[model samples]
Target: MLCIYNLQLTQTHHFFHSKKGVPFADYQGICNWLTRLVQIENGKQLTCNRNFIAPLCELCCASSLQIGSLMHAFDSVKSALRVLEESVALNCEEETTKSCIQYLEAVPWDDSEEEEIVKVASRLGPIAMPIVARISPVDLTATRNVFLSALRFATSSPGGEGSGLPFGDELRTSAQEQIEYMLGEDEETPLVTADDEVRSVARAGLAQIFSSFQTIISCSLSETTETEALHIVSDLVWMCNVLPKMDMMKDFVVRWTEASIVEIIEDNRFESIVWGLKVKVIEVTVKVLEAVGYGTVILQPTLRVQLLRTWLPYIRKLKPILDAKAEQDPSFGHRMDEDLCQNIEGAIVSLILALPSNDQGEILAGWMSGEQVKFPDLSEAFEVWCYRTKSAKRRLVEGGLDRVGNGNGRIETTEMRDMTMIPSAMVLIADTDRKESLAVKGSRK
Candidate 1:
């Protein structure tokens, strides 16, 4: 039976790779053939032998398959996964799940194999996670490792040179576009077309994979040390930063805010965390706030207040280090310190801008009046807020709202004039960075 199966598999491989070049007809044919083989292997007559399963597993593990073949290959693997899931349910066969995991684990993790790995994980993860969860701890850990590895593979940079690809930003934008399109409601077309249905399914599947990835990250954080947890927290924040765009995953934001963000902000060990880690956390937090603003997701007022309270101290702590570094080396390297300060201020500005207008005033007042406020970034932020408020007030005046009462029987001019007219600190920061880059390049030349 094993020899016959191998021969058939080889023949199928040849059929798909023929010079005719994978006709559309071959997709269903391959799927049916693989489905039938799985049925026979899982049938009562075959005694559910492990040897019979090895050939089928090998077929799934054939990562060398071309793109034309991968579609059918993944379909077949999905079928095999179903068969294993059924066997585990009916016969209590833990070995079947283990074997499936082992085959998935064997998939290569280099550039050549990335797309296949992504396809497999995106398909198999949702199916495999449930079964893996029910099995032993060893199996769970093994499966988690494989899933995390595949996730890192999928999201990481293609050539593996830098931090992971900006998948979070891409996925967030895609989700936002989809949501906007769906919400437009401009048409009431009768029947949903096949393409629309397929896209809907795809979105749902992607959401599931995202949730699984979050769970894996959260679980990893629970088991790791503080340093490891910091790394995981960075990933968590990165993921959370993008998640707000997907309305379906709003719960993730709540989970992150309550579980991780609060702890990181409130923890007394803030002084002990290294500078790089601190930067990562702050950057990701800023990203999360920006995502919130773009999506217009309304965070709880208390949470907003807590974010400001916690971030202020960190920004204060960061300033001395940055100032000290500038004093020590006021050269090209000082550009980095300036950049960090700019980023920290950018985050503060974003956070403040995300607040309601009334709340923004309160937050700005506290920051500008605080005795501990030593960073120039705070003043920069204050200037940006003043400029924005001035813009808003000007718009109101142009719109003829100047005559409107403040609901307190007084004009609003007194409040608007008190705000200063400084240039946008963000644009100034950008121009400075550009000039610095050009100067550095010229010096090097």
Candidate 2:
């Protein structure tokens, strides 16, 4: 009995001190060491080699099933976050900073573990949101970004888990507010300085957030939300303005323009701000025109029609506004000082010209005759018919007046000709009238 008890004691001692003398370890053994490390009295004493931890994480994330076995991974990560938080709080020594980084390194780049980190960080987002929020280092932008990226990845992946156990719908709106907080409020001004994969991933996450704003703008019921929706639209436009411009991304611009036209302007709610709103429309119109002229193809024909269709009615309305206002001011409404008129005219002309040339005259003619066609304002239509008549006359003069010729090649030779010369006939009639008047005056004399 004494011999058996002594053997058991020796075995237990050997098991507890197994890692004391080992210089390096196999991957599986490192996890067991990590599991045991958490239980140690002085957990910080065991030096964590990032080299071993990182590789082990890579191997674990590569297997989907291993995630279930590593559920307690968050404990170590939470401890690391605590160290990081405290360091930031104390603004401690450089050595403490080094130790904080070491702790982070040991947390592993595994997707599952990274996801767990995100779960903890999400609570910080809305909780940290304060009244009259301001962007600053204290906002913890980097950590927020890291958490967001991980959260998005895990949620979107085919079989990854995240903060909201089975699934989360609020992720979109929540993520949107968090990012918009950083972007709009200027918290830490997250710079783009990473490789393509990282940068693309980040941009995609941001786009998703903005997409939520698009939804709100679409579904908003109240005037206040509608106005707020416009502000959000402005934020999105600002984002597009600041980012690297791409041809493919013009759809968002189109959507934004559509929303502006339908939601804000069409209802005519803000009548006082019509001019400002019109100016915005004009700017977007110019962009669309340039895109069309340059042969940038946006797939939505309805969007093209929606934007183009607004032009004529808007222009005609502007004519009345200019005329009414001009009646009030002599200098300000000087006929030649028609900047708005010119812009509207130029936009219509460019848009028409951009369409096939044949379409221009036809649509213009319809517009002139009040045919209610898909294009051309009444002014444009009248211009078209007048130009067509003058063009025909010019052709008749250039090619003998006996007949008019067209691209069809030949005019009929048998066409009727005028018996009297127009100029000669007019002169003869005038002379006869003068002679008769002279005869009558002589008789009176």
Candidate 3:
């Protein structure tokens, strides 16, 4: 019995001595050691001991670390989160996961370190979010709070000065790349399992981030100067372009349209903003409409009419600028013109097609008469409308329908020809008007 006791004592001493010899006193050493702990096959068993727990808690409490060290520390924290998630998934170790969460929650975040905080969040969010999403009932509130705090730091104007320039483009690019990697593209398989719980939690987290983003933009628009507002709007547009591409974020389209499009249109100050800012706003607006137009959600009739009223004037105002730029640099400017025109026309046509046939006819008639509405070029819009109508008719015919349209039976070939001829005539009229206007301007010049 004495010999057995001695052996046990020696083994315990050797184990602790080895662990104590590790330089957890230094941040880099702590990170390295924690990374190693994360890689261990039995991660839960390793993390349960005070040797690992105490040092992590100590590191979290440290307030004197520089920004560079904080970033490295966050990397280690991310690794630790991965380990905790894997351990819980493999062994249902709720206690270990809880302890890890508490340590992570203790980490102090300083608002003064905005850029560094953003860097850490952008890197850590992608990794930790997936794990938090997948793990079962592990109380990730503390972890999620950390992520939200980081995002708020990232999106807000630096130092509460309201400069509207959140950070450099590189940080935005890095955050976007990380989010893309986490969410994956529409065609690609998701990085996590398709479990309903996982998707639910992930969506909830994203919704929080988006809500925070909306709040930031609202505050910026109301409180900031024109230059600052431009900064905010530019960054918001970049985010809108990125977030809508995630396959799981279908609702982002509606939320973005409601927040940005509706708000911008209603803002009385919109017309007074700089012309360059107006163009950026229009670009983002068309992008939202195009993305959501492809989806099943139909815009309300009132909103559709409002959008037409708002965009038609903007398009007319933009035509001269586009024309001059295209004349100066045909390649780049024409490409921009074509892309913007296609997006706007496609979106408007989609909205028109969603309306009942009677409403569609009314809208078309209004455009043709230039009575209630006047657009820069109705030709492209009419072309898209004709093509969509033809496709619908073809599908009906292929399905063996003898007639199309509500209450009008047996549509004849002559009616189809008339449908095509009317738009062609309108196109000719529009072309004539445009040529005459250009000639008048040229003579004056």
Worst 10 residues of 1 by lDDT: 185-194
lDDT of 1 at 400: 70
Which segments of candidate 2 are over 4 A away from where they belong? 1-230, 236-244, 253-260, 268-282, 294-306, 322-347, 366-445
All models: lDDT?
Answer: 0.47, 0.43, 0.48
C-alpha RMSD of candidate 3: 15.8
Candidate 1 per-residue C-alpha lDDT over 70-92 given as tens digits, one digit per residue, 9 for 90 to 100? 33454344454444444343342
Single out the weakest 10-residue window by summed lDDT for candidate 3. 59-68
Best by TM-score: 3
The window of 10 residues in a row where model 2 has the poorest summed lDDT is 415-424
- Flag the better candidate by TM-score, 1 or 2: 1
lDDT of 3 at 155: 51
Provide the TM-score for each candidate, comma-separated. Answer: 0.37, 0.32, 0.41
TM-score of 2: 0.32
**Candidate 1: TM-score?**
0.37
Ranking by lDDT: 3, 1, 2
| Residue 28 lDDT (model 3) | 58
Across 168-216, the per-residue lDDT of candidate 2 in tens digits comes to: 4245335534544444424344432223443565466446645655455
